[model samples]
Target: MSSTAEPAPAADPPSAPAPAPGRPSAPGFGQDRLWTVDEHLADILAAVHPLDPIELQLPDAQGCLLVEDVTVPAALPPFDNSSMDGYAVRTADVAGATEEFPAVLTVVGDVAAGSGSLPEVGPGTTARIMTGAPLPPGAEAVVPVEWTDGGTGGGAATAMSPAGPGDRGAGGEVRIHRPVEARAHVRARGSDVRAGDLALAAGTVLGPPQIGLLAAIGRGRVRVRPRPRVVVISTGSELVQPGEPLGAGQIYDSNSFALTAAARDAGAIAYRVGAVTDDADTLRSTIEDQLIRADLIVTTGGVSVGAYDVVKEALSSVGDEDEAGAGIDFRKLAMQPGRPQGFGSIGPEHIPLLALPGNPVSCYVSFELFVRPAIRALMGLKDIHRPVVRATLAADRTLSSPAGRRQFLRGAYDAEAGTVTPVGGAGSHLVAALAHADALIVVPEESSEVGPGTEVEVVLIG
Candidate 1:
């Protein structure tokens, strides 16, 4: 639970080698050597640290983690209050009262909620109390309006008459028809929370119920770790904005929008920069311009070894002059769909950056594996990884995966049946299949083929 705001320096993965000057290192660049998914994730997580704490109003602090334990200032209820709108009477007066013969008492003035003064209930008197109104002095129990005549002198009254000038039972006699016990129907002081009690512990996320509790404990503002500001950039030459007419060899840009939304879902304040064409200088300048507001930078498209990979070409040399170990490391991972990946720090502040592949499915998978956890770590969340469960593979035939490489296939999981069915073919560009998938079926690198009915690990992403 350290509150230090400064991020810890990123360490190079054991499998990754140092980059050559003016270019990022791609370990085993021309060979078969590659980093595992776990290795790449560890490096990214090692570099991220929780953001600094800041004081924010209750409404603005929703979903933020509390930086310190908050204690209750006063007892919840603060005083004895009524839980029903009925007569507040002494138990002795209402004891053994029934429909055959009821205990009659004169009603005093109404005791509405927030009333400063309270009327005393003596041996033969009762006070009409509203729900949440403080229990008046000398009143031992409350009779719900449904259990009494409600001052109408009628049998089995349903509700208490109004207390204004047109009301007939404001100061009239009320007949109690039920026996009562002391303190019944009364919310005792400190019943919910007592003074000085820990209302919320440190590292608690402030949701609606937690916010209500904080407000009940009189906490108008609290200290919490602010969400990280994430800047999402997509780079490609043939990318066009959605809603615009597509020219030949051009496709709509979706990576930046998807990643931006995904970042927000991970509890980061995300900004989506429009797609930057395949130009090294433009991409580099765009990333530089966004550094002012970015705590983490995520770029889709251009980490592959292709000639048109502008992201790799532009960011390979970034932050190299600022400090040693300050540039991105582009490398291949021993995984399907998302193989080409890059991670490192950039800018004077050394903000963390993740470079993902260009394919739609590859880009999103990389985000879930790397960027999502980074954002959660920055937000000070304890459980940063997605939930994983074991499920039987629901397929008609055996599935194949490349030897020595782990494969993650989009899937539709049925929790009730404890089975997962693959959504579509294992193509990195299958955005339609990715959209329908609620889970990722994990095929281990050691297993080249998996048969139907085999139990496999599934990562729940829905």
Candidate 2:
């Protein structure tokens, strides 16, 4: 049997190849007419490219890829400042000081942060300095208030009392109970970063820390690959919005909400459109209207051969005649539960679109296997696929799969135990099972049965 484990999907510069000759076609597909999962994924990735980088405010650029290296315009801290609210005095003045026989110094004035003017500290004198306050001239070190008498002329004081409205007199005395070394409790200039240093490199993903660093370096705006705007549409006449009253044979539209949330989780700015009815004209017009704001379009349902398959009928000839890379290709895949699929570019801009099956589990699995990677790729990320691991199958009975088809079964992966147990049966409509599953158990095309304790390739979803 051929290896079922496939490498992580990457963008390849080739269209999907046709089915091999003399190969038995899966049921409902014409003889030797089916595409492999890798082929479909490659085609989708190859067609989609990263969005152009744009300058955005720091807040808006969070989670985006930096397109250029950000350099520090000025050194961090800007100047030598106090790291503590304490007395800024010459190091020699505090030397040999002790609690029993402390060194007394005159408190000339207070030095607060952002103070334009300063008090110069001469020998036998010190200044009361707040945290982050610049060291006054002639001061070589800072002695924390805890190590001094806080100018109260008592035992070692715990804190400095604020001067009242009428108590603004700077004529006080402070007793230094301990000796402080040079630069003690003082932040040296450029200690964190130097001017012209590369703060962040290109291709770096900007997280909270990175954003903070950019702001620290005075970068109010930055250049980054913007998040792709994905428009998700679920098509079906029988589908109704959630929280609305349900009529006969009408089911709540979960695919749009699910796929929209999935797109966001994949680092996209996703918009969930109201479900479209089973009319080719409405579907086509809806897609055309969304093109103005969409970087990628995803639709669920109506890609199969059913007579009422609106997606296939609507998008079959969607490309403009003048457009080069347009038109959708509806094809069956050699996979279980998600055989019917459609992918191609449409509209004047030729935005890429993916049409998935209607079944809840199938639609969701197809999204993880295809849409997530596409979104990451559009964000200029190199690693676009979910993590995978090899695990032993933990099933009571042997698992059965269809030959010549790759089946992805939802499973509960016990990472600590390194075992994965299948969730629910092999039904594509099992949303409850999919909800409880954190991984997918892969069954290769050539293998129809998998016994317990056999190792299998598991895709970690959660």
Candidate 3:
């Protein structure tokens, strides 16, 4: 053997075993292998886009997204107006007036609200002004009518005075019992909103307050983002419409109604697309029709791997032979109550479709967790998601969860202790539990066990 130990046997290169047949390829090194709630959400959002803008009148502008900036049309209170029903006087003249030693000022003229005519008050003169009346020239203050006794009651007293014929009556006078500050009881012009100032900016979601702002700015109509129209359907032959007689193993369809309400609350127009059986052909036709007619389509049920599961199979069939198949892009999210979720573009129109689980509670949770946020984003809402906060456990308890999945458990939030107590059993099929819960407490994937006094992030539902 040549010296040097025949060059230590050539080290064998690290080998990657081939992927098992019918199994997905192993994820690249350093890349994420499992779908997180956020990752799946990003993929779902990357599909359909927002709608175009439209012009709508104020009567129809409720909940519409404002597309343009609104500026103050004119200064509020076009002119300095009186805010009190009283006598307008020169502050300098009444500066020392009091009940004991009153200031006698000759009554000049009266100014009513909305009157264009205004007269100047000379020294020792006062103008009778009503609330909302423009301050007359030379008037620097308002003395409430209650503080002034017997004003020039419209100058008619001079004509009706008890004096001999051909003898002119003396002009009536008023005694100022109190002094008021200059500009008192007056709302200065442009005080509320100055002209040419921006009152509302673009992309503002118009609510009662914003609508009132528009009216104040003299805007009778506004341009806004079009309301996203959505169609919701429930699939499952075992589902029956409410108010109808139920047969064996059948329950009333609730997910559709719940989702529709959720969509509207998110600022989107929602319409029921009706229910469909487990047949692939029927579902495909129904979904196609909905895609052609709606901006988005949402359905519950038929997405799992059970024998009755037909949604995923139908979607795969539709995607066949098409470069970008209309097939549903199902995401097995590492989240409880909403694992069997699907998102994809539908048909050539590329309308967004989201398929949620059929469980009544799961569908509702998925809508709150995913669909509603998307709708809010499209409608230009600022607070798109429900606010989340840390809460303590109300009682000692155990929550079982898969070692690697983030679990969302329904519970009630106690404001006093800033804690959330789990509501009912930890099963996704618990509809009563869902109804009683006021929030969803989040348990991170890394923690398989959590005990009392441990801080947790909770989503307030109520």
Candidate 4:
């Protein structure tokens, strides 16, 4: 009778789990925050600022974007030069010259490259000139060595003899077998670029050819966004060095090496901190040591919810201990193989840090999706992402993925066939498969399965 009277008691609502350190807890129950790929990319980009411009040598500035319009300081070539190693002559003298009845001219002298002495070509006279040699005065055109009778009245020759060509006897008298127009085989002063002309605009990427142009304009150094000094570290107690003998349950440390190389490929000056054991104080100390040298910091293996995730434990408190805004915010992204990520700034300098997953393949995928773009952005590059192409799936069977996760599978892309074939199964531990892959096949969050012949977006790594 008493139990029946007390049967109408009220119950309380279930509570949501508390958020992790440095992460803002969701407001409601059963609601976990999940970031889209674009959301995560935007957050990363917002944290990065382009490096300050510095004057670097031409070779050092290669692959870096120019921060200012590089005007031609001096006219390219600086003076008119001969484009061929032959005779510099007036067009009028060789107007009707031919092999049968060639125009004979007296050799005034030879003009080699970098020759300071000048030679005057009077009427009925020519100057034997080398390629890149400044054109002698009073010469209106040039006759290539091949067009003449080798200056020896013999058969055709492949090249003109180099150095003191005047001593070769052929330089004494040259037969003008072919007529040349005005300025023929002669590069005019500033023909390539004139003084005050814009040789390269601001934001131009300096490659081999661009560097050559700058050198031609007499620019030994240029102002450009400097390459980011990235520091990469790995943390795992069960990880062993590659050459060391492994104990039971030990795996070789690969994230450090892979991430360092990837950072370099992204145009950052990467410094490998190797692997640290599962110790929060050690990780904290190591990061402190690297703060002075790092423009960006990358850590692998410690941003998860596990009890022993030292990176999360160490860096979560950095904001409070050091200066303001010095902590990392760990995120759970709606993506496969690289869902757990941590990004933030640390120390007095507020250096950006990206903490990725522990799995070898997962780390690499994270690097391509986030680290690469961050590095390029730091170098003031306009295009940060890898080239994406639409390709047809080339699998024999349909490929399945997690329903709500955006999956990135390793693939071998056939550029000619315009198809992409998955390299391995959906396993994050397959390092070998990732190595064999040259592309990443992206499956959308809403698409759980993709069949052969289906069009997909592929990120070309090659």
Candidate 5:
């Protein structure tokens, strides 16, 4: 050895870092690039914003969120009306009236629903009013037609069969047998909702009942966040159409159908594209073609680091900053079945695309974990994910999972017992098991094994 180390021989040109023992030096297929589910979800959601509110007709606004507080422009009933097909008479006129001693009154006229010409009832005069027909000017009460012998002394009448003016009261005289109180069986103006009252709050979801209420308040069209249009694509060379015969190495494409239904269940209008082959150019071109109709894009498969993992290879250069849209990024998450994923924007409009694993179970789980929330966010919904509940394990054996990965095992939840039973094993290809599962039992990353009676979090998927 020279006197101290002959001037450190030019620090041997900084050799490149060595790859970890069994992991790739690059990001793909490597544990070093794994993302937590929450981390990936947060990133996907940060880029998503609610769609602009538009005035859509009542028929088109179903499942959409209301943007503004809808006020009742006019009273819900608009005017006093009869709630049943009966005689409209003054309460005092029919006092103590019964079948034995009936108060006979002259039939002024017949009132039908939406009739503009309403007769005024005065003193002993009465109007045969149909349900929803506006109350006559002087009427104070209404008695069912059954109580008055159906104006025919015949058997009980199911309805007032007088559809035309010619058939209006062939029975000239009407006898009011039973007595009625003031406003009896009458729908008063503003009884349901008054003018200027709130018909629906700003964030109300427009279901059938809500739409009916808005219509009752004269809201033919209202401002609402429109339903997102999701385009679902499945990429795999070994995939075939659902009805078509499969070859030796081919499988029917189920991810597209499953995810499309899932997206619709999450309140998006979903369109499914048949499986794209394992070619990068074909997948990229197909996505470009679908961009015009897509508010969000979801693709399953071709995201892993296999030789034919075309989603990464194809969409990696999908968007350029010089163009109008952005690029897609693939990521691996620290979760079972649904670890391989991708999410980003693409095309001129910069729509969001979520890439899930190709396996059927993994694809569906990924949808519930990620795509559903993204769709809800686009629809301006505050609650995004499926509600999770604490449930006890009903399994007889302890469940095992990988050390550092959060495991979501398919489960059948018994709501009454407040327990969840695992459906299948830890295999990601257990599609049949997934079909039987109504929920997912979430086992935390730190807890590798769970015994019976252990309380676990269950996410409702049904």
Candidate 6:
């Protein structure tokens, strides 16, 4: 009997030396693969702590995380107000008034909103009131304003008295063609919310609707989670910032912009720190400055062992001694594209640093697979990851992955049918491939060969 229950499906086959036939390897690609996805993820997560304190103004605080609960200082609609523009009459006067034998009352003083007088509707009198106005004293029902007339045509039939015709001054009354019910058309005070009720709990992410709600409850300001400050630096001597003159062999620096946008979309304030050449000293100095003012630091390129690669060396310098120069941990994971992902602390400040490989596609993939979720959690986003689904492959292709590492292939997800299909050729440097992909197919480490009909899990990217 096998002890491991079906051999637990190998994550991927170990990379054989001289590499598997027909598969191309980057120059000097080693036979030994370093970190596993789970291993590196654990290390990365261990280095990060929740973000620090922040206070945002209420109007500008929509979509901001709440650091404290917001309770209603007072009941909604603080006082009993009318819900309709109608006549406010004493219930006693309209008790027996019906269409056949209507009760007639005199109309009294009109109560528009913001009026402070406490006008009372006596027995045979009524008061004209507007919606949202406080219910006049002794008012029982509000017959819509459209239902009442001047009453001059019927010889005082519209002119009625208050208190069922008891005292003087005509006292303003309402003619009721329909029988009255207790409290009908009258909105009771605090009916929507009790005084001092808890409107929202701590850690709540405020939305426009929630902001409106808070405003309704009289809260002009609210204490909310501070947005993390992220500095995105794209490193490459051959790159130029967008809108700048492109020298020979120079490509537009897009990683920094894309990553910055991604960070902002995750609810963080991001700054692009410009590009750095492959020089180790320059990279180190740039990161140090960013670290002092930044809560999160992300750098693209040079994480691999290529001669032009200095990100790995710079990161290694930042890792704890046995003291590397800095205190960062740099290693290649057993995955494609993002294989050379680096995570660790930098300088004396202990700033968390994530060094993604230079390949645009690689950088984006690593961020989506790892950093995005972490950022969302810190920023208190409701849905941490893009929705994923299981589906069958639409086409078949053979790709080699380390037996111990899982592979994430760019693809598209058909949500209605719950199927995922690869969007383009599996090329790590193909940025266009990523553009067309809507999701990522998670091919297991043991999946040496997957046919079109094979059931697989996909991580929705779009």
lDDT of each: 0.83, 0.83, 0.74, 0.81, 0.81, 0.69
Please provide TM-scores, in order, for all candidate models, with all chains considered together: 0.90, 0.89, 0.79, 0.88, 0.90, 0.78
TM-score of 1: 0.90
Alpha-carbon runs more than 4 Å astray in model 5 = 1-31, 152-159, 166-171, 321-325
Task: Give the Cα error of residue 68 in candidate 6, in Å.
Answer: 3.3
Tell me how far the alpha carbon of residue 32 in candidate 2 is from the true structure, in angstroms, after superposition: 6.5
lDDT digits (tens) for residues 309-412 of candidate 6: 77766655542334222355555577765777666566565666777877777788888877776576557555667677789777766544546557788888
The digit string of per-residue lDDT tens for model 4 on 1-462 reads 000010111222343343334322221212246666776777778778799999999989988889989898888778999998888898898999988999988877778888787688888988878899899899998899888875644445443654454452334577878889999999999888888999999989889999999888888999999889999999988888899999997888888999999999999999998689888888888888898899999999877667677887888665334565556777777788788878877877778888898878778999999999999989988899999999999999999987777899999999999999999887887889998999999999889999999999999997
**Cα lDDT for residue 155, candidate 3:** 29
lDDT, residue 60, candidate 3: 76
Candidate 5 per-residue C-alpha lDDT over 1-462 given as tens digits, one digit per residue, 9 for 90 to 100: 000010111112323343333211222322245667876787778878899999999999999999999888888789999998888999989999987999888787788888887788898888888989999899998888888865644335554554486555534667778899999999999999998998899988999999999887777999999999999999888888888998997788878888888888899999999889988888888888888899999998877667777888788666443453366666667788677777777766677888888878778888999899989999999998898999999998999987667889999998999999999887777789999999999999788899999999999997
lDDT tens digits by residue: candidate 2, 1-462: 001122222222334344333221121232135678887787678777899999999999998999999999999989899998889999889899999999999988877777656789999999888888889899999999888877855445554543444443277799989999999999999999999899999999999999999999899999999999999999989888999999998888988999999999898999999989888888888888899999999999887656677787788655463565466777667887787777777877878888888888889999999899999999999999999999999999999998778899999999899999999998888888999999999999889999999999999999
Off by over 4 Å in 4: 1-32, 152-171, 318-322
**Candidates, ranked, lDDT:** 2, 1, 4, 5, 3, 6
Residues 1-462 of candidate 3 have per-residue lDDT tens digits of 000010111222343343233212222211223456776666555544557788888877889888898888899867998998777888998987888998888867667787676768889888777788899999988887777775655423232222244322235688878888889989899988999989888878789998887887788999988778889988888878899999997777878888898899788999996678888888877877676568878889876657777887666555222634344566566777677777766666566678888877778888888888777766766677898999987756667666767788888999887989999876666778988998998888888877888888999878
What residue pairs clash in candidate 1, if any at all?
A: none
Residue 294 error, candidate 4, Å: 0.5
Per-residue lDDT tens digits of candidate 1, residues 273-365? 998888888888899899899999999887766667777778866654356457787777788878778888887788889888878888888
Which candidate gets the maximum lDDT versus the true structure?
2
